[model samples]
Target: MSTQKRTVLITGCSDGGLGAALARAFKDAGFFVYATARNPAKMQSLAALDIETLQLDVQSQESVNSCAARIKQLDVLVNNAGGQFVMPLSDVDIEAAKKIYDLNVWSQIRVIQAFLPLLIASKGMIVNNTSIASVAAVPFQSIYNSSKAAIASVSETLRLEVEPFGVKVIDLRTGVVKSNLINNLKETQHPKLPDGSIYEFAKDTVEKALRQDGFEGQGLDQAVWAKAIVGDLMKKNPPALIWRGESAWLSRIASILPHGLLDGTLKKLVGLDIVEKAIKEGRH
Candidate 1:
């Protein structure tokens, strides 16, 4: 009878976020869980649960190396640390967008490359937490949307490349899940339409639409979401792509639909129809 508990390490486990929720779920599932965040102070609640907490800045090679060097065994690696940015694509802040890509896309690759030796040694799994946004083309989220799309592509290719090493890769095409993502954004920067921007006419509508879901709590409960995700990952033969959380079905549907079919509806939902009207009226 083997009594060795499986070990799992998750990044971005700050309190009130999806990573924290996932760390709890994995802990409850009886795995040895390492919950990490750049600021370890934010993970106090997780630490109180006796879950091992570490500092991990996914964007820093030094941080990634330091974190990996401490872990002696790992069965699952969840690339869950990420951020969101919302703004009109036309006037997108190139530097801000680049930061988003660095955190959301390249950082995942960096972490994977740093930890591949550990994953390969265990014949473990790599779960990349992507979003339905990757396929949905939601309004005013071009930077976020594109970054997610890029990771999805990376996960797809990495799955094949890692399979030969007996490692599994799962692209978690997440839907809306209740977390601190939006609130954190608001607290940090309060995203707004830039001054004198072309979309200024639709500023209130666009910004409201952007924050609506987060404020209204329209997503699935994070604990439930994490439980479902962990269950899938625990399967003897887990899926290559796992879609869970609120509105995940919509992402699946959108993926198969003809391109541009949802553009009009998506636009109207985010008040882009009003923007279009203003543009046609030459009111700017």
Candidate 2:
């Protein structure tokens, strides 16, 4: 029997993001933190803290398999590597949407399967970081919503399957957080997002919405959120779903509403209603 403290490996833990915050929180809770990112250079600050840093790109099976192979044991696996792009479902490039799903959905499946042996050995927990939008699907974020919803579903199935093996599975219904999400938005240049004729009404508003969700983020605090998640990870019997954050309440509310009502509510909230009205009035 090994007497070493539990080890936690979190993906996409570059600096200035929630994954990094989670690594710090887990370390504070006395766990060995292996914080990984596609580009290890981005995690130099975390490495400076003596946290193990690896270049693990969930998008690449070779990267995931190699990282998993290096670890003899893992107590917690946090699937936090995900990305998104905002655009109308109509205008979104299918290829771009597929890429988001590959990162958010398939990537998680790949990592979890690769780490299953270690998890089964330790009877450890797996936390798949999903979004509130999973069940609270809103417009213009269809691709993101769909990908996260798939996570929620697959996590539930994973929980059932792994329970007999004594492995706990958690779908962390993450709310909007303060992190590089805003930076990601700023770093990317999307011509259609701001000035496309079809997107004129909502693009700027959507940009504001994403920035607000990441900054003001409705009072989202990364440190606080990470603390909550780490606490759950340490529990002897954690919930199947650890749901919290700025949008958690709204997500719950959205779930109770009818599809039509929910869609209408989201349109108004994100300025999609204005765009719809313009289209109805035949205005360019």
Candidate 3:
């Protein structure tokens, strides 16, 4: 046992998502946990667990700073809150796209920056809850995937930058796990495509894809991933990138395939024929 009882702070801990699972696992592993979300009431169930729930709106500087001030030390910080918006690039409102990025990427950055001093003080670690989408570039989910992709790159850079300061940065590439992200996706639909838009065909495909309750692939088990993540965090030497869950290996394969192959696969899966025909015919 590492003698030192570390503290872990996780964000976006709804009742049964990855964050909540992490909170429970870390607590069971003998770490003090600060579990946070936009609404503390949503986390009422967590109150019964061995953890402290706090209010944290990652996009708000005031909220991030305030929480950072209250924590005297931190052994691990997990940026686990993020979700997808159901809007094609052509129909995507600029404000909505920005909203997705703000929560998925910038919010994680803000939380990490605000707590850097404390993490360093404890010579701790950071576990960025990134996704296979980070590298796979899924169609109809460009914004969400891209935002996570940005975080993965950021995690890589930060690992090196902060290593000399005695803090380890780990990027966790998670595959689909049973969570509320699918159920809570925000839908942004424009009845008519924007004039001269290039993505009119993508609109319908995007809608259908978003409506589908993501296939809980045999690999997408929440409890299993949670256990694996906890095991890594408790290791004597943790890996820089922890890849697990149903789609983890598959997405990694997608990331390395040639662009043509990747695009063709995505097209077939997302009903590209409908969108492509719409594009050629200029039908909004």
Residue 88 deviation, candidate 2, in Å?
0.5
Error of model 1, residue 62, in angstroms:
1.0
Model 2 scores a TM of: 0.90
The 10-residue segment with the lowest total lDDT in model 1: 209-218
Q: Lowest summed lDDT over 10 consecutive residues: which window, candidate 2?
A: 210-219
- Whole-model lDDT, model 1: 0.89
- Whole-model lDDT per candidate: 0.89, 0.83, 0.80
Among all candidates shown, the one with the greatest lDDT? 1
Name the better of 2 and 3 by lDDT. Answer: 2
Pick the winner on lDDT between candidates 1 and 2. Answer: 1
lDDT of 3 by residue, 1-284 (tens): 12257889999998867899888888888888899998888887789874799999898999999888888878999999887765456566788789888989999999999999988988999999888878875666778788999999999999999999999999999987887665565333322345555664465565566565344333466777888899987898999999888768877787677666667666766676677777689776
Candidate 2 clash pair list: none
In candidate 2, what are the lDDT values of residues 15-50, reduced to their tens digit? 988899999999999988889999999998799899
* lDDT per residue (tens digit) for residues 34-80 in model 1: 99999999999999999999999999999999999998788899999
Model 3 scores what on Cα lDDT?
Answer: 0.80
Best model per TM-score? 1
